[model samples]
Target: MLEGLMLGLQSIVEPQHFLVLLIGVFVGFIGGALPGVSGTMLIIIVLPITYGMEPISAFILLTTIYVACVFSGMITAILFRTPGTPESVATVFDGYPMTQQGKAGQALGIAVLSSATGGMVGAIFLIFLAPVLATFALQFSAPEYFALAILGLTVVATLSGGDLIRGVIGVTIGLFIATIGMDPLSGIPRFTFESAPLLSGVDFIPILAGLFAVSEVLRRSRDDHSIKDTFQKFKTKIFDFPIIKKILTTLTRSSLLGSAIGVLPGVGATTAAMLSYSEAVRWSKHPEKFGKGAPEGIAAPESANNSAAVSAMVPLLSLGLPGGATTAVILGAFVMHGLQPGPMLFTNEPQLVYTIIISMLVINLLMIIFAKPFITIFSKIMNIPYSVMGPVILLLCVIGTFAVRNSMFDVWIMLLFGIIGFYFDRIKFPLATIILGVVLGPIAEEEFRRGLLMAGGDLSIFINRPISATLLGFALLALTLPLLKKVFSKKTQPPPVSG
Candidate 1:
């Protein structure tokens, strides 16, 4: 592992790779600081640019953006009570309060410091845990892969903060979308509607651009033209050692919790951050200070959010499953590059894989420098109005999607998915699940069919395989546990007194 990591380090320092890494850091900070721009959206918008680059460089840029953007989102959440990303929502609880108290510097400092620390912890998790997971996954066959894919979809739906029915609905949409092209086993058109363009099926990039980026444009179409708000200005290094000592416990706890949660497929940093914040409140000596201006409050969620953001790579690298929306997009990058991420990737692309792991450490260190002196600069970037922001991003989406194949049909597909995405958003369906379902649906169906063929049409083959059965068991749990927990919680609640 150390030898691989050293090789990765050497590779990243090469001129081309290093330059992209720096660009990722810079772009991520600015994009994340913007209220309407998410790391996922930024990745999709800029994805086409990476088509000409090396796979390692492409991944380094996207993953770096993922980590940096997650941390920078707290900047706006702290300064303006408007979270730059959903993952930063918990930060606003204490972050903005500190700003209102004229301690914005301290809050920003604590948040950034904790975020960096958390990222390092997550990197450590990736370095140590991912390889082990990959090695174990080497034993998987078609049955196991199918079960893993099913588990991935279930986890996304269950943890995505909505009713199971809605989540299922989202997954169904993605599965239907996945079935648009030729059958893998049989060379037959499935849903082309006699259209030549549909013969190639739907491109993931255009649909992704639509669902995330262009849909964001329509989602913000109703907003006022100008954001008349400004940051509570502050000055200081984005680190404070004195407070770090006080919140060490919070940082350590949240970082571990975040990295662990990150391993669960499709459970993103948003969930990790909120859970960590609540855990901080549960365990704090002065819980009352949390909603006011508690440093621990800032540390807990920020640390977990960034840690989970980085560690989300673990599943993507090891299991071929994305742990969140941003990583799902990263998974697309892998596929675009003709690289399927999984156990085989570790064997086939050790240099690229290890370089990515090592790059996590680099991203965290660079993030401190990227954020420290540029708080004001990022603040200005975030203050740009949605009206202007929306149009620019929409234009980028069009240009990026069009560049992929130079086809107008692809552009039209993007627009069509945009409306689907808009409707999905209106119904409060999690986009991540649809991405997962679309990505995983093919894997599950393909693997199931392949497994059955291998088993000579015996239905018991899936259950007879130990690893496959275990994975399916977990999938069942992922699907049912959340609903069971909700039911139990409600039933255990004291009945309302006839109100």
Candidate 2:
């Protein structure tokens, strides 16, 4: 293991490789710090740009950006209440509160420290346990995958921003939107209304752009209030080992949760972050303090998000299964470079696997080294006027969605969703739930069909397979636990007073 890692490090130590890693991190920081843009979008846009580059160099650069964006999300979340990515939504709960309390620097420091630890833990797991985990991952069948998606969908109830009903509504809307394109099993289209573009289903980029970025821009546009604090500086450094240790503990828990979820066939980073945050809240001594400036709040989701980012690579590299949309994109990148990723990847191209792992570690170290001094500078992005910044963000959204297929239709779809997103925001709907539905809906549909076919359309098939049964059992627990808690709480509580 050590020898392989050393060989990998040697490969990445080349000047050109170092340059690729540096460029990726730099781009990632900007992408993540900018509101309305995500690391995934940046990577998708840039994938074509890396067409002629060596496979290793391209993957190294892309993964560096992927990892860096996870960390840089804290910048916007802490300085402004706006989250740069859905994964950082939990960060805004506590991070912005710290900023409001004049502890922006301290919050930023903690976020960076926690994200590094989370990312490092994830990288370590990828390096050491990818083989073992891949074996377990292969055990999943269609029913099991369906159950996993169901489990993820249930998290919407917990992450409904304290409004369980609204969360359910948001999830329903998301599911409906996901159904807009062609039907998965049948050739007949469902809700496209005869538009050719709609036959492909709603594009993830445009929907996500509308839901997250454009909606946020509109929401921020309505707010005329200015921040009261002239940004304050704290002497908080990344090397504060005591704080780092505490942050590590929190990140470790979240990372483990994320990795486990990512190893599952269909669930992805968004669900991992949401579930981790919910678990963090459940485990906290003061659960009510969560979403009200609790440090653990930020740490949990950041850790989970980064961990899921890495673990998603595992299935793609080892099982020839893309764990999520981003990993699917990465898989395409690998194939473009004439490399096939699967179990044979390890034995056939051990050096390539190790190089990817080592590059992750090195890129993280470089990101931390570079992000420290600029923490204060990046936090100042909060001061930019909403009017000036919002249009630029919208423009980027337009460019990103259009760049995906170079289709004017996608751009129009983005604008249409932007309006839908604006209304969803006004109605207190959760965008994360919608994105999860879109990402996971097809998986659920495919698996549900496959499982039924295997059982000859017998409903008992869900219980016939042991793995399927166990997964369904877990899904039931996920669904019922919240209701059980509420029921028990109500039983123990006094009646409300009349107004």
Candidate 3:
């Protein structure tokens, strides 16, 4: 291990590799700070560029970009209400609120710090514990995956913000949307209505951009107030040591949880962030402060998502399994270079594997250093008036949505979802619930069917496996706790007197 680490250090310090690493990080920062351009998109765009490069250099470039992009998404989410990527969706709950309260600097500081810390922790795991964690992840079958999806969906209760019924309705709507494409098991279209484009299903990037970016623009357009006027005297500090110290517990807990979740195949940073946010709320001393600009709220999701983004590489490197879309793209890069990931790769190419892991540590530290100055610039965005900023944001959203698949159909989808998001916002429905359902619905549906097939159509398979049973039990508990609390509160209250 020490030899491998030393070899990795030697390889990364080479001028060519070091230069590519910086360039990759810079490109990723720009891409992820833009609405609708996710880390997956950035990597896909850069795929052809890596064709002639050496395998280690290509891996270093792509992985560095991947790590940096996840952290950069929070910049937009904190300064504006827009999530640069879906993984930053949870950040918007508290991050934007903090911006509104003129604490943009503080929010960005916490986000950057938490992201760096979480990323380092994940890199350490990737270095020393990748094999062990990957082995444990191998234990997950269809039933366990299904149960995990169910557990992720149960976060709707916490996301509802006291409107459980409305939250359920929102999630139902999202699930319906998710079912529009061809069924994974039957290979038949379910809700395409015979439209060819619908057969591909709604792209998540467009939906996410429309919901957060375009909807925010529409909301701001209706108001005559200027952000600068609203908070004329407000000044923000780059760091708040006291606040960081206060939220350290949440940060540590979320980082660990996110890394653990990231080891599971097909579960991405977005799910990790949502689960971390929900758990932070569950364990918080003042749960009511969540969604209201609490420091812990910003810390939890940012830390978790960044950590998850890094640790997600574990499955790909160790088990030859792509943990999420971004890692799937990385796997493609590996294949293009005539290298395959798995146990054999470790023994066959230990130097290259360790180089990638060690490069990630350096990339993460560089991100913090590179992003510190930008936080000040990003925070200044809040001072822009709605009239000027709204159109620019909408235009960016349109370009980003169109760029994804180069389809006008996706642009229309973005516009439609933008309006839908506006209405949902007006009605005070929880958008997080809908997003959770949309993201997790397909995973749950596919895994559930696969689990049933494995069990000869017996429903007991979900309960028969210990891991699956535990995850399902947790999901049920999460779903029922809110209702039980409401019922008990009502039961304990005295009857109202007649008027």
TM-score of each: 0.97, 0.72, 0.61
- CA lDDT, candidate 2, residue 236: 51
TM-score for model 2?
Answer: 0.72
Candidate 3 global TM-score: 0.61
Least well predicted 10-residue stretch by lDDT in candidate 3: 227-236
Best by TM-score: 1
Better of 1 and 2 by TM-score: 1
Candidate 3 lDDT over 328-419, as tens digits, reads: 55765676578866555777888789889888889888877888765555445545555665676567667766776678899899898889
Model 3, stretches more than 4 Å misplaced? 1-132, 229-360, 375-389, 489-499
lDDT string for model 2 (102-168, tens) is 7776777777766776677778878877766545546767776676567656656555765667777
Task: Answer with 1 or 3, whichever has the higher lDDT.
Answer: 1
Candidate 1 residue spans exceeding 4 A from truth:
none
